[model samples]
Target: MANHKSAIKKIRSDERKRLRNRYQHKTARTHIKKLLTTKDKEEAQLLLKVVHGMIDKLTKKNIIHKNNAARKKSRLAKYVNKLVATA
Candidate 1:
């Protein structure tokens, strides 16, 4: 539907970016779920670090809101701490 060549190129580029963002978001969510289900304190701690990095990257890329990232990281940290406390 785009009549101009530039508009067509923009649409193509936007599609690619959208796919990339979707993939990253899905991957992050998968990791978060894995972390949430982990019973081992050591493993959970490792996953917490990795998940935090992924969340920070998403925030920096503007794929997710900063507050959303912060909330995720906070909850994850609390969960990991609770695991440690129990152990």
Candidate 2:
């Protein structure tokens, strides 16, 4: 339990931030999933671009590490490229 008033306020702020981050993360995951599930290369590429922007925003906001974001983008891009090649 937070004994001090400041600590209590901090706890409240933390909770709010946690919820915000979770929402953003879940949204990002859903976008990525949609991109992966897309069969059309052009559509996938368009979704990938949006996902890339979302990842970058997450990284900038410190919701996820920059390297982690980069890795995800790289893998997603690779997958999109392979699909394009196959189609």
Candidate 3:
């Protein structure tokens, strides 16, 4: 239990931020899953643009690390390229 008013406020603020981060992270994961499952190269390419933008926003906000975002984009691009290669 926080004894100081400032500490209490800090805890509340932290909780709100935590929840917001979780939601954004989960949403990003969902989009990533969708991208990974998509078999059509054209659709995946379009989705890649949207997902990349989302990842950039998350990285800028400090919700996700820059390296993590870069890794995801790399892997997704690889997958999208493979789809075209296979067809």
Candidate 4:
């Protein structure tokens, strides 16, 4: 219950941003999981490209930590490479 009009508007904007960020983060996680589960190297590689881009963007926006982004990318890359090598 914001008493001031500006304060109310700020709260509304914050809520909107929060929801948008949450959506993006969730999407990123879902895509990462999908990539991990994918057995097809080609498809998974494509998905990894997109996922990596999403992670980089999130890192740039400070939605996730830089180290977190790096770690995720590293692990995913390793998994994807293993799939590629085995295929």
Candidate 5:
């Protein structure tokens, strides 16, 4: 469907970027879910750090909005804090 060579290349590159972004987003969500289910405060804290980094990277890449990333990080921190308080 692409008429120009540059347009064809762009399509290919876009597809690759899309797949990469999807993978990163899915990985971050998986980590977040694991963190939420974890009962150990120490382990959750570690996971929070990792998840935060992933979220920051997603924001940096424009895969997710900055506000969305901030909200996610905030909620995760709150959850971890609650876990710490409970245990």
Candidate 6:
């Protein structure tokens, strides 16, 4: 569909970036799920750091919005804090 040489190149690069972004987003979500499911406070605490870092990276890259990242981080921290309080 892209006729111009530059247009074709742009399409190719966009596809590559899309796949990479999807992978990173999925990885961050997996970490968040794992963190949410863990019963061990210690393990959850550690995973929270990794998840937060992943979220920050995504937000920095503009894959996710700043507010979206903040909301996710907030929910996770709240959940982890509740776990800490209960245990």
Taken over the whole model, the C-alpha lDDT of each candidate is 0.95, 0.93, 0.91, 0.93, 0.94, 0.93
When superposed on Cα atoms, how far off is each prediction in RMSD?
1.5, 1.7, 1.8, 1.5, 1.4, 1.6
Ranking by TM-score: 5, 1, 6, 2, 4, 3
Q: After superposition, how far is residue 30 of candidate 6 from its true place, in Å?
A: 0.7
CA shift at 82, candidate 4, in angstroms?
0.6
Q: How high is the lDDT of residue 86 in model 3?
A: 34
Assess every candidate by TM-score. Answer: 0.95, 0.91, 0.90, 0.91, 0.95, 0.93
Q: What are the per-residue Cα lDDT tens digits for candidate 2 across 1-87?
A: 989999999999999999999999999999999998988888888899999999998999999999999999999999999885334
Compose the digit string of candidate 3's lDDT tens values, residues 1-87.
999999999999999999999998899899999999998888899999989998998999999889999999898888988896335
Error of 1 at 7 (Å): 0.4
**Which has the higher TM-score value, candidate number 5 or candidate number 6?**
5
The TM-score that candidate 4 achieves is: 0.91
Alpha-carbon runs more than 4 Å astray in model 4: 85-87
List where candidate 3 sits over 4 angstroms from the true fold: 85-87
Candidate number with the higher lDDT (2 or 6)? 2
lDDT of 4 by residue, 1-87 (tens): 889999999999999999999999999999999998999888888999999999999999899999999999999999998885334
**Cα deviation of 73, candidate 1, in Å:** 0.2
Error of 5 at 51 (Å): 0.4
Off by over 4 Å in 6: 85-87
Residue-wise lDDT of candidate 6 within 10-45, one digit each (tens)? Answer: 999999999999999999999998998998788888
The C-alpha local distance difference test score for the whole of candidate 6 amounts to: 0.93
Which residue segments of model 5 deviate by more than 4 Å? Answer: 85-87
Clashing pairs in 2: none
Per-residue lDDT tens digits of candidate 5, residues 1-87?
Answer: 999999999999999999999999999999999999999999888889999999999999999999999999999999999885344
